[model samples]
Target: MARYPTITEIAQKLGISHSTVSRALNDHPRISSETKQRVQDLAQQLGYQVNSSAHAFNKGESKTIGVIVPDLSIHFFAKVVRGIQTVLDQHGYCTLLFDTSEKMESEANAVSKCIAHRVDGVLAAISMETTSFEHFLKLSKHEVPLVFYDRVANFIPVPKVISNDYQAAFDATMHLINSGCTQIAHITASINLNNSNNRLYGYLDALKSAGMEIDEELIHYYHLQPDSIDTFIENLLTSHPHLDGIFVFNDYAANYTVNVLQKLGKRVPNDVSVMGFSDEPVATHMTPRLSTMKQAGDKMGHLAAQKILAIIQKQEPMEDEKIVINPELILRESTR
Candidate 1:
């Protein structure tokens, strides 16, 4: 087997000191451009690569950031990761990604691993089961900079990048009301999530603004069970036969709700209009394309990455602050 090339080998071939090769490879300002180029040329020719672990040990900096997401299968989170990579890659930092599968236990374990690895910083979107943030607090005790995005711990004193879920939900609900929907139901996610709670408030306020009665029965708090949606729709239809609209918190749930509505012989838009949030890909692929609020997942991720980087670089201090991105309402066949 061919052994991997080392910095010492590159230095020997270039007739330069290993220190010179190291500085040149790192693009240190003290290294002259001519020598740096020669060192780089020989290193590339020899298939030499920097041993990041060793370099991190020597410098006491990992140059790696930990990114924690509830679920990687979600398109919105996937886009957020892409946006994070776009920034981190340009700054010579790699990411250690953790998919917590929307479970609090997994999220806690991921945090432990990040701390064990001594990551330079962390960006996280809390899982649905994350009602308490004690696990996240461990990172702070270790002095690791953290930034939350999308799903967040509201009480945590750290930077958060989030969409204006309240405004988006309000606007989406108002759109349904303006389209002649007198009796509208709502489907929201786990009550533990701040975004979901904000969306619920927005939905409620929109109904109140329209002089409509707030019926507690008309609102369904979804708990990630598809079968529950079926039961909820069946009961909703029986209780309120004239239900004309639905505003859901996320696009996937909205798509599922639409399917359930169709199975119950209700025609979308004609009988009931449906609006979803996040504008995920599933929204467009449905039979009647879903009308939704476009939450900029990529932008949110970018902003979160920038915030963590700033804190890590000492350019800004980590504090309790929020950077909000307003969502855009996209009209489609799902709504009138």
Candidate 2:
């Protein structure tokens, strides 16, 4: 590989010392304007670019932000990444992304790698099984500011950005009740997840508020597998017999459920009403559009980025601000 010219080479070409070249490139006020302009013009002509790696090595700040998500395949995480990039780009900062795919150890290892890279900060959505927070402290001790988003650590002192899960679930359940769904069932992800637990509570709360019995049989914990979901739903149908409504944890699962229900010779909304969360691409593109909760993934990502920046700049974050942006109920063909 061809080696690029160094600052010393550029200085030699411009008939100046390396220190003068450094000051000129960095726009130091002590350097005369004419000298700085002359050096800059020469450096540009030589195709000079500062070696950021070397600069970071000396300064100990990479000017890079590391972002970790559960999985990039999920539409919601992808939307959040786009929003994070938008904000990071505006501030001349670069983003480094890591996908944990819901693995607890992967989440910890990703954070360790980010710290090793000397990143200025980190933005992470804690993994589904992340219970030990020792890995996070490694970053904190280095003074690398971290902002948790979507799924986060309740015990971590870092500021977090998340959708209003309780209210969103409450409103989604209420919608089912308003549709006259007396036997509503919920298909949700890991029961240990705060959002998942909150959604379950919301469903039960809605039932109580509507003067209905909270049946334990109506709750189903979903494990991702074609056969598992099929059997679960089949058992649900066979056991409940009167189930009229279903709330899925996410659009991908909802899409799969729709397919499964069709195989069982049931029509959506007409035979059974359904609702999903995250409003993924499939939600709108499906034949019978899904009624779901809309989380502002992009907005949440942008806020997470901004919060990390504020913390890095030593600006006092709204200390008491635990931002919970409300989720919208997107009404469509899936519900009446």
lDDT of 2 by residue, 144-211 (tens): 88888888777777788888888888899899999889899888887557677777888888888899
How far off is residue 16 in model 1, in Å? Answer: 12
Give candidate 2 misplaced runs (Cα > 4 Å).
Answer: 1-3, 11-16, 24-42, 52-60, 317-321
Whole-model Cα lDDT per candidate? 0.93, 0.86
Quality of model 2 by C-alpha lDDT: 0.86
- lDDT by residue (1-336, candidate 1, tens digit) is 969899888888888898988899999999999999998888888888878778786888999999999999999999999999999998889999999999999999999999999999999998988877888999989999999999889889999999999999999999999999999999998999999999999999999999999999998988888788899999999999999999998999999999999998999989999999998999889999999999898898889889989998999999999999999999999999
Residue 260's C-alpha lDDT in candidate 1?
93
* Best-performing candidate as measured by lDDT: 1
TM-score for each model:
0.90, 0.90
